[model samples]
Target: MERAEEGFGGGGILRQPPAVWATAGASVVAFMGIGLVDPILPSIARGLDATPSQVSLLFTSYFLITAVAMLVTGFVSSRIGGRRTLLAGLALVVVFAALAGTSDSVGQLVGFRAGWGLGNALFVSTSLAVIVGAAAGGSAAAILLYESALGLGMACGPLVGAVLGDASWRYPFFGTAALMAVGFLCIAVFLKDQPKPARKTSLLDPIRALSHGGLASAAAAAFFYNYAFFTVLAFTPFVLDMSPYRSGAVFFAWGVLLAVSSVLVAPRLQRRFGSLTVLGGSLVLLAADVVVLGYGSHTTAVVCTVLSGVFIGVNNTVFTELALGVSDAPRPVASAGYNFVRWFAAAAAPFFAPKIEEWSNVHMPFVVAGVAAALGALVVRVRRGSLVPAAVEPAPERVAPEGAEVLAG
Candidate 1:
């Protein structure tokens, strides 16, 4: 039997190695890239003399490349090792982010963002596997720590964007480049090259892993959920129509709730109701909140927008766990597969939301997001039996798969 001390309840979540801390700190910066442009979207549109939809392509191009690159991340990381892959990814981000700042046109900005996405895909897909390998206690603890970093990065990204972007839209891009350079140095110094897999993962491995029922179900659900998630992230700033500071402050509040709920609330809820149940319920709530956000007054929109963070936080945690453990595949391969399937929606949402608004009314996009969230809930409900493996408690002392270690030494 697993010892109680090895579990998340044992305070193992707080007792991580220097390697984990460094990686986590870097992860905070890497994830900051996701929302760093939030407060500056309008600024970019106006600065480049572009429309909102055109500026939205920044997200579309980034995530589109990110989704496709998911297939190659495991392939590359498995060959060169985790530490090298991480450094390479960080370097790419540093270059591309700096280049993005110099873009004189929306087309150039979108092109640069696509390069950033490729780097991000490599980093993000590998980071979870590294943390899970190096972390003490169990995979659960590692996952929680990862989620915490995500929340904190998300919370800070908009504020950074607002502060730097308030001076000029170009500043946020340069700032991201500088921060990622620091993250690159930290990773280079603190993280050793992880053990390579006995067998190199093929590009097709992630695609094949989707043959498993639980993994497929989880990926499908996440696909729908990501649409709503990104819609909130990408579209709501326009809805708010506030200054960079006010928008930053609002998203900061939302991100704070996201962090708090994912770290503090999600585990307790999962322990009681199980992961799928919690995920399903949270999706339903998100669906309702989004629809209301669409129809409500500005005050109502702001409140609902902040509240959506809680549901999003819960879903993020649960979905990540499911993607990692739902299949018999290696953790990195499984994650790659899962992300490959779901990130398409991340690409789609930003593109579609504005187009939908342009075609119909402003409210219609939120309604579409609500439907997507509801569809995510439906997938969870319909596929509940298949997700049983992920719903169970992950065993303590779960070791990294062959060749996927992120050991500090």
Candidate 2:
């Protein structure tokens, strides 16, 4: 294994190469696209004369396609090479986001969002593998860099949405398209193509990878946690009843806390508490927070919403590390398998949250989210032994075996 030898001690997190930084920057933009429409959901619904459930299909279509596309990311990347895969993904996002902005109906927007998700699936699944292979510090630092980008992007998405969506719901779409174009340019100029895996992955590889007990358990738990996670991200804006700017502002605050905790706090916590313990505790806490948001007063709900970010942040880092490390499968295949399972929940959350509200009440959706989070914790608790090794030792770094393009040092 040719791991980057940089130790975690000192300022390792800040010591990445230019290519890693470029990939991280592009990752931030890719994640930003996830929540960019959060502040604008209500506006889109009203403008297009669609109901909440109809508008929520934006998340459903996007994540549904993303979830399905996860199955193919490894296959595509193995064949096309990482740089080409990333560029292709970014190009798709640029084209689809622009088309989404021009859409006149909610249906068209939903369809375009599905296209965006395909691009996202390709970029996100490959980015981590690329970082781990080329990063200056060790695998841990690379994971942190990736998570930092996720947190920062998640934080910024709603703010951008709120600002642009205030003027017109369509503007956020254009904004995203433009920003992704910049990301495309950045990757094109700075990132060299990564070596392909020794063996080209098949569509079945991710599924086969999940046969490992640890990987399967982690994926299952993440399935439930993602249900809770997306509930907060996709459902709360409608419940907040605030203007787009106000909703964006609230989510922005939440995202800031998420970013800080993921990049800064999670590593410290993992070092002290161990990853499984930290992950279980965070999932439990997130469940409790969702319960409070569901049952509390409006002011209390707002506070709980912001507070959930902390728990979500911790879980994201721990889970990513676990998924990449727990199985013998290659990082890209394992990630694809893990994501394929989890993102179904992400797709389900937004689509079902509103429909559940219609069937019961606003509070019930959070109640279900709370239960899902608890289940995620339970999965971790039961599968403690398999997951523990990942916590106790730093993951052994492995580069693509042979026969792929290697970046120049």
Candidate 3:
């Protein structure tokens, strides 16, 4: 048939063609390349004879830049178009990946990694826009797939890194670079950006649009979820390290299983229960997961760690979908804004959660997850009620997203 529809396909809730899926798959590989190096940073620093305080900058820089970059990505996507932004970003990652593999000092490594974060911001923001644009039905299913890819990448990172590190720590970074290049090639050759929007989106327009009710709530939830996740994920390896385990095997396994579960079932779950159900149930599971993991026993610790991934993956995907659908604002900007807050919270988690964990136990971070998830669920309940519609509600006057024509009653 003719290629896909103009401008990908539908609205935030819309779906794209098989080509979009392939592009998304490549995007995941690019991201996994980044993620693989992150989990082992502490060990890498030690191997390079660097200090822990200095090494921490690797994560801090990435998240800080990512948060700021996400805000800009939305506006840029509107201006330059999502396809170009994502493709360019993937290419940049290839360059940074090679640079990272060649670092002579912690300073150089940190700086190169910072550049990598910029590329990530572009990939995540535009890829999200593309997936949302490409969706055939609603953004929820597409968004879930994106999140699942993220989980898959995240899962693969540490497992691959651990194996590579066992051989030579440098191998991980080098292999990651190779992966990034491959991902770049895949996107450049296959994925195509749709035509730019007919209207020019002003610099301040997205900020003004997010002033709507559901949009703000969705943004808030995304921010909190990120904080919750980063807190646990950032700390877990340290926690596992403290145990008698030989190395970071536990955290690595946890990531692998989380990614597997998210990929294997997230779309089906979204199709069956809808975003609200997934969000609510996932929040509860997260609370339970954190509590169990926090207790810090042998069997309990491992089980809890794995559950954290499972709940967090499902929570993030569902929340992303909710953010896209619940908003009365436009889809692309809405997704970008929500991710902006999410990454910001993630950026901040390391700076803050340590003190809380010091005050209580490792479980304290999970407590935060429980609270954040609860707040997110409350927002969803108040805003969307449920993903399933028992009755019809009229579309609002605002129509910023592509699906609006279908929604406008």
What is the per-residue lDDT of model 3 for residues 308-383, given as tens digits with 9 covering 90 to 100? 7777656654555555665555666666566666677766766565556667766776677667767766666676
**C-alpha positional error of residue 303 in candidate 2 after TM-score superposition, expressed in Å:** 0.7
lDDT of 2 by residue, 336-367 (tens): 79888988999999999999999999899999
lDDT of each: 0.83, 0.83, 0.61
> Roughly what TM-score does model 2 have, to 2 decimal places?
0.89
Pairs that clash in candidate 1: 196-403, 197-403
Using lDDT, rank the candidates from best to worst. Answer: 1, 2, 3
TM values, all candidates:
0.91, 0.89, 0.75
CA shift at 27, candidate 2, in angstroms?
1.9
Q: Which window of 10 residues has the lowest lDDT sum in candidate 1?
A: 400-409
**Predicted structure with the largest TM-score when compared to the true one:** 1
Q: Per-residue lDDT for 116-188 in model 1, tens only?
A: 9999878877887788778887776676677667778888988999999999999999999998898888778
